[model samples]
Target: MPANPTLYAYLRGEILPYDQAFLHVSDLSIQRGYGIFDFLKVENGQPLFMEHYLDRFYHSAQLMELAIPLERSALQEAVFHLIDKNNLPLSGIKMILTGGYSLDGYQPVEPNLMIVQQPVTMPTQEQLQKGFEIITHEYVRDIPAAKTINYSVGIKLLSQIKAAGADDVLYHQGCVVSEFPRANFFIVKQDDTVVTAAQDVLKGITRKNVLEIAGRTFKAEEGTITLQDIDQAKEAFLTSTTKRVMPVVKMDGYAIGDGTPGPVTLALLEELLKLEKHSAQR
Candidate 1:
């Protein structure tokens, strides 16, 4: 047998070396790009909001019609085991369910489950305060509720985003704002109401927490936000597992408010950090 590897992955009912985790080429995920995934952050040896992530993961599997072989409890146990084995304190865990090997290479079979751990670094104060810019695109995701592995459109626009001097792309449909590629978008109205899209967007875990935190101090609502609404907005920001609360200073070459990280955005970030610390303790 080979020697023990440094990193490990939970794949197909086994904890194996990260490099050894493999899926057959005949898998529908490879042939038809059929799969779903959910990612969550781990801090100080604890998985943050694991229950919520698991809930979404299972929901995505159900939507994709991929049956996860492991029970919820068993999956949770495997996740913990993988984390303990890898021993990465500040990291992110990715849970993936892929359409398994198919006889015709186009049909779904027994799904393959994979859990991987990778190191993660939080944004520095300078990076957070500087904020970022986003270019707008007039497109919406198919099956927006499920967290699938389909990112072809977003990935294809990388060149356009870089050419436009932006960090990411904000998706919209018929002038109605939706979400970013991997993040949820929120805009603060002139009246201090924080609004995010209510329909046709993935309900992100970070987005959920931000809405809850913002509601305590502001009028937070899940409703339609349009390009026109953004034009009259006071400030804007995004939330994701990696980007907890990142201010959006510019959109399509115009400044959002004063073109800097707004006070409300900064305050929410602080509260989110505190909440995360408390969560780690629990």
Candidate 2:
């Protein structure tokens, strides 16, 4: 990880030294677990899909009723300023809005906003070539539509998932596939149809773009994906800001398709990388 003592962060309305950006223990986000945050990548000192992420951040805050103390324009300025201040060639930027410190450590108060810039490494090409397996847990997020700062159920299963030789958890209710802990899930049918769950999903930015790419290159559908459907899938993959497009080789203990990255999976990855390159250049 890249680290510099000179890195700056935005706290509330003030730009401060990174180490000085601290919150009171009694803040609602700390005491009552009330907060909303969004993270996206920066390439060549430019943030990608920042406007889309910021829109989701505001909507998440609205869903939790945790008011953000800054307007969109002000928040954007703060984020850009921090990026310039940090100046990491590649990084992941997180924008957070917390329900303010409460006198009783319960009720909401004026919110605290923060922009944290951190150096990050993209997933390795070797990891993608070998692909990764994911385990399914019978769980669903509290609010599937909102990107709120709550990951209790997902993170709690970290040990269980890792022990199973998996990279992540795909949450489902009964036999119907919903989504992964932090990413969107998709599977290709025997007939090469790309299908992903539309409802009960976080609607990730990477997911949105992949669906568009699939529509142009292959047949794409958004609907219910059951375990039975997965069993019959020719390919499977997960999408997220960090992972981009990741092939899923196995589910539970069963090998998906031929236990290798399928043609459709590779094609989408290639196109997505091209898109990423274009974004980086611009």
Candidate 3:
């Protein structure tokens, strides 16, 4: 007999067994795919940059017209309670707010909130040095500012991505480059200026940290980047909560600056790790 599962989740106002956390079929999140979510990392029992994550979460709820049932302080307390119950030292915390159950299944009602904690592994140095490849797709997300649950297009392109021998897809509009399905894109210029798309992208927490770290050693700015700009760039990378800083050595089957992680990417990754360590200690 296998040991019983011990994982737990926070649903509505109660902390319950993970498997018992459920939402009705009439929820707009299920019927209309209306919802928003935010994820943050926890290290050594400390949630990193929690306030920043909460700020984004509340902002997303407001944008989606979904009201969070709990106050900010109450939500924070619930998160901590969930963390303590799960007791996962190194993990990722996912906060999900969904359109609640509705009789008509077309209009917004009381929103459902759920939080889950799961173990996560950080990337190794070898993996970072080897980097990964990405294929380009000409599509953009709906409501790119809010962290909505509508990843239909990205999910539908999984086969295409794997068929092309790529790890992910980079979305673009004609020649204008935007971002990856789950990460924000960045490139290094010949003059060492770091640039990422300024519009039509979800501003990721890790992306913000990278910009701040890069600003100390190089010129970091957000603006429009096109395929032509990437073609002439010296290096490329992507950032997200899970990926941290991942080098993009190839795009659309072409080598990006020797097809390996560059100095700028590696330096930024080191500084990011340092920042995560310091932030976790706080």
Candidate 4:
């Protein structure tokens, strides 16, 4: 891997190198995980569907009672600045909005803005073709709809999931399947219905697009999915800004359908890719 290049971080209106973008040690976002953020895909040099991501980010920040000091357009420009500064071909951009510095440790201030641009690389074709196996965990997220930083349980379970020979973990409370560590989950039925959780999970951008397109071709529903639902699924996959539409052939030592990517999953992938390609060109 190329040595991680130095990337720029924008704080308030100031641009600083990564190491210089420091937060107060007592910031509530660090002490209590009181922060909200968003991620989006950057192709060539532009962030794809950035406005949608920013809208959601602002919503999450507002829900958490944090104030963004910059306009959405200003934030988008900051991302472009980092892209050019780092000379990145493909990248992932993130903006962290937190209840800024507090000497009292609990007092709130205007949100601190931290923007980062990092190199983007995908799993090799060999890795994708082999498919990823996932482990199911019993952890649950608090205020699941908000993209906050209090992700202790999800972060803690990753190693155990990887040790179990899986690329990720699907957290389910008893029969209720919530979501993956950082992606949304989906399952296909023999009848060609695509099902995934409606709430208590991040409403992924790719997930939204897949549902919109699937409306024309196959049955798609956003409702509660359980471990039982996934175990019994005819096909399964996960979606995210990075993963896009990925096939999950197994979970927790059990084969998903016939241990292969299913027809519905492939069809949605093809359709989603075409839409994204067209959107990029526009």
lDDT of 3 by residue, 11-108 (tens): 88888888788787999899999999999999877899888899999999999999989899998888888788888879999999998887799898
Candidate that beats the other on TM-score, 1 or 4, i.e. the better one: 1
Per-candidate TM-score against the hidden true structure: 0.97, 0.96, 0.97, 0.93
What is the overall TM-score of model 1 with all chains considered together?
0.97
- Per-residue lDDT value at 250 in model 4: 90
Give the lDDT of residue 132 in candidate 1: 85
Looking at model 1, which ten-residue stretch has the lowest summed lDDT?
1-10
Clashes, model 2 = 0
lDDT of each: 0.91, 0.87, 0.91, 0.82
**Candidate 2 per-residue lDDT over residues 163-271, each given as its tens digit:** 9988888998999999998899999999889999987899898998899899997899899999999999999999999989899999998999998888998899888
- Per-prediction CA RMSD (Å): 2.3, 1.8, 1.9, 2.1
Query: How far off is model 2, as Cα RMSD?
Result: 1.8
Candidate 4 lDDT, 1-282, residue by residue in tens: 333437676776788877677787777888777888898877786678777798899889888888888877787777778777876778888889888887677888767888877777876667667778998888678878888888788778878976897889988887898898699999987788888888688888889989888888889999888777776789999988888888999988989999987788888988988877766512
The positional error of residue 192 in candidate 2, measured at the CA in angstroms, is 1.4
**Candidate 2, lDDT over the whole model:** 0.87
